[model samples]
Target: MSVKIEKAYILKSFVINESDRVISVLNEKGEKISLVAKGGNRLKSRFQGKLEPFSFVKVEYFDRGKGGLNSLNNVELLENLQKWIKGDMKKFFALSFLNEVTDRFVYEKERNSKIFRLIKHVIDSLKDGVDLKLAISYFSIWMLKLSGVLSEFNEEIQCLNEILAKPLDKLDCKEPQTIFNFGLDLISKNSDKPLSSADMLKNLI
Candidate 1:
C-alpha cells in the first residue's frame, strides 16, 4: 500500500540485531507502526539521525501483509528534538510518561484527529519552551478529555480554573500525583464517560 506519510514522529527505537532495530512511530493519521530498520543503530548509519526518538520526520513505506505494520522505504527528517531530548529530569519524565500513555492507548491504523492535534500541540509546546509542568498537565487534561476518558474542565473542583491559570512555580501541585487523583475524582463525579487506566491512576496516586 502507498500512502502519504502524514505527521510522523519517532517515538521509540531499539536494537534487535547487530545492524537492525525496531522502531515505533506515531503518525498524524494516529497510527502506531512497528518497522524494522537496517543498521539504524550504527554511529554513522543512514538512519542514525532520522530514527532518533522524538525527532519529527516525514516518511514513506511499503506493506505486504496486514494493514498496520509496514516496511519503511524512506524517510525525510523534519525536526530534530535533540535539544529538548535531554534536559531537566521532571520535564523529561513528564514527556516520556505522556508518550508512553499515548503509545498504549492509541490503536494502530485508527485515525483520531483530536489525538493527532493534541500531540502536535504537545510537541510544539515542548519545543517552544512552555512551562514544563503546565505543559504536561495541560496535555494530560486534554488527553483525557480527548480520549473520552475524562471530560470538560469543571469549575466545581477546588480552584481548578485558578490552578490552570496560575504559574507553575506559584501553584502547589504539592503532590502532583495526589492532586491529579483528586482532580480526576472531581471530574469523574461530573463526567459521564467511562474511566479507564486514567481513572485507575487515581488509585495509584
Candidate 2:
C-alpha cells in the first residue's frame, strides 16, 4: 500500500469499537474521505487530540485503493476552531450546521476546489469575527451555487444580491433574518432528511 499525506478538515467522527474510530474529512482537494484510526479512542493514542470535528489537520494514511477505507497512520493538528467558540452556543450550532451541510452535499472522492476554498474562507471569516448570520447565509448560497441548484437569476435569492457580491468579512445585511430563512428553506428542500442542527439553530435565533 502506498502512503499519502494531505491537508484535511475533519467533518465528523464515529467510534467504531473500544479503541478504533472512523473519521470523515474533507481534504484540501475538496474530496470527502473516511479513514480508520487505530487506537484513536485510547487516552495515550497519538491521535488523541488531533481528530476532533472542525479541525484542520495534516493526515498520513495508507491508501488501500478505491472502494475501501484508508488506514490512518498519523495526524498533526493545524488548526482547531472548537476552542474559539467554546462557550458560545450560537456559534457552536452555526458551525455544526455548516459541517453537516458540507458533509451532506460533498461527494466522496470527487474533487471540487471551489467548495474546499469556500469552506476555508468561511471558517477563516468566523475566526476573524464576521457577522454570524451573514456568514451562514453566505455559505448556504455558495453551496447551492456550487452544487448547480442555484443561479444568479433565481428569483428567490434576488434579495441577496448584495450579500453574494461582498466578501464575508465585509458583508452587511439589513434584513439578515430574511436572507437566513431563504437560505435555510433552500437547504431544507435539497436535503433528503431533516438537518439535525436546523431546529437547534432556529430555536436559538
Candidate 3:
C-alpha cells in the first residue's frame, strides 16, 4: 500500500458499523475521495471530532490501489464551519444546498481546480458573513460555467456576464433572488436527480 496526504474539505461522512465510518471529501485537487476511518465512531477515537462535514483538514491515509477502501490514519483540522453555520437555520440549509450541489457535480478522481477554488472561496465568503443569496448565486453560476453548460443561458441573460466578472465576495446584484432562482433552475435541469436540499432551502427562505 502507498501513503498519501491531502488537504481536503469534508463533504460528508457515513457510519458503517459500531466503530467505523466512511468519509467523503473533496481534496485540493478537486477529486472526491472516500476513506474508511476505523474506530471513528468510538468516544475516544482519534477522528472523533475531526471528521465533521465542512471542515478543512489535512489527512493521511493508506491507498490500497483499486478494489479496496483507503484506510484513514490521521487527520489535522484546519478549519471548521459547523460552529458558524449551525446556529442559524438559513445558513445551515444554504450550506447544505451547496454541499449537495458539490457532491452531485464532482466525480471521483477527476480534478477540476476551478471548482475546488470556487468551493473554497465560497466557504471563506460564508465564514466572513457574506449574504447567503450572493454566495449561492455565485457558486451555482460558476459550477454551470465550469461544466461547460452555461453557454446555453448566456445570451438570454446579459447580467450573467457581470456576475461572472466579479469575485464571490465582491458580487452584488440588485435582484439577487431573481439571479439565484435563474441559476437554481438551470442547475436542477442539468442535474441527473433533483437536489434534496433545494426544498429545505426554499422553505427556509
Candidate 4:
C-alpha cells in the first residue's frame, strides 16, 4: 500500500498496550482521523516525542480505506507545542479542553476550513503569549462561531454595551444568572451569521 503523508495536529492519544499509541489527529484537511503508531511509546520510539497530544507534525501513514484505523508508516517532527504546554498550566488545561472539543467537532476526513483555522489561530495565539483567561474566552467564542453557535450580534451587542456600562454593583443587584443568560440568548440567536471576533473581545471587557 502506498503511504499518504499528512501534516496533522495531535489532539488526543491513548496508550495501546505498552509500546504503541492510538492517536486522533486533526489534519490540514480539517478532518480528524485515527492512526496507530506502532512502538510509539518507548525510549527510542518511531514517533519519538512527536505523537504527544497537541503536537503538530508531518505524519506518514497508509490509508486503509475501510475507515477503521489507518496504519502509520513513519512520523516527522514539526511543532511539539511544548512551548505552550510546558509554560502555562492554565493554558495547558485550556488546550486539553479545546483539543477534546475539536476532536468531537471534526469527523473522519470531513473538511471544514473555518474550524481548522479557528483552532490553529487559537493554538498559535497561546504559543505567542496570549493571556490565559482572555485566550480561553476568545477560544470559546471562536469555536462557537465555527460550530455555528455564534452569529452577528448587532442588537445584542448594543444591549451588552449598554448593560455593561452600568456599575456592576448597581445593575440588578440581585441576579448574576440574568447576565449569563443574556449572553447565552445572544449566542443562540446569532449563531448562524458570521460572528465578529472583535465583538466577542469587546464583550469580554
| Predicted structure with the largest lDDT when compared to the true one | 2
Residue 55: error of model 4 in Å? 0.9
The residue-level lDDT of candidate 3 at 179 comes to 79
User: In model 1, which regions exceed 4 Å deviation?
Assistant: 65-68, 151-155, 158-205
Report the lDDT tens digits of candidate 3 across residue range 161-182. Answer: 7778988777657777877888
On residues 1-205, what C-alpha lDDT tens digit does candidate 4 reach at each position?
5678988888888887888788898888787889998888788886777788878888899888775689888888787776746675555566765675676556677787666666787677666765444444444545555666534433433333433234222233233334344544454344444334324433543
What does the lDDT come to for candidate 4?
0.64
Q: Name the regions of candidate 3 deviating beyond 4 angstroms.
A: none
Best by TM-score: 3
Q: Which is the better candidate, 2 or 4, if ranked by TM-score?
A: 2
Query: 2 or 3, which is superior by TM-score?
Result: 3
What is candidate 3's TM-score against the reference? 0.94
Q: 1-205, model 1: which lDDT tens digit per residue?
A: 7644555777778888888877788887777777776667678887767877766788776754485457776788888766766675555555565566667657666667767667777667667766554555555665565567544555565535545556433555534544465544544454455445344443332
> What 10-residue stretch in candidate 3 is worst by lDDT?
150-159
Q: Residue 202 lDDT in model 2? A: 75
Q: What would you estimate as the lDDT of candidate 3?
A: 0.85
Where model 2 places Cα greater than 4 Å from the true spot, the runs are 151-159
| Candidates, ranked, TM-score | 3, 2, 1, 4
List the candidates' TM-scores in order.
0.71, 0.94, 0.94, 0.70
**Could you tell me how far off, in angstroms, the CA of residue 44 lies in candidate 4 after the best superposition?**
2.9
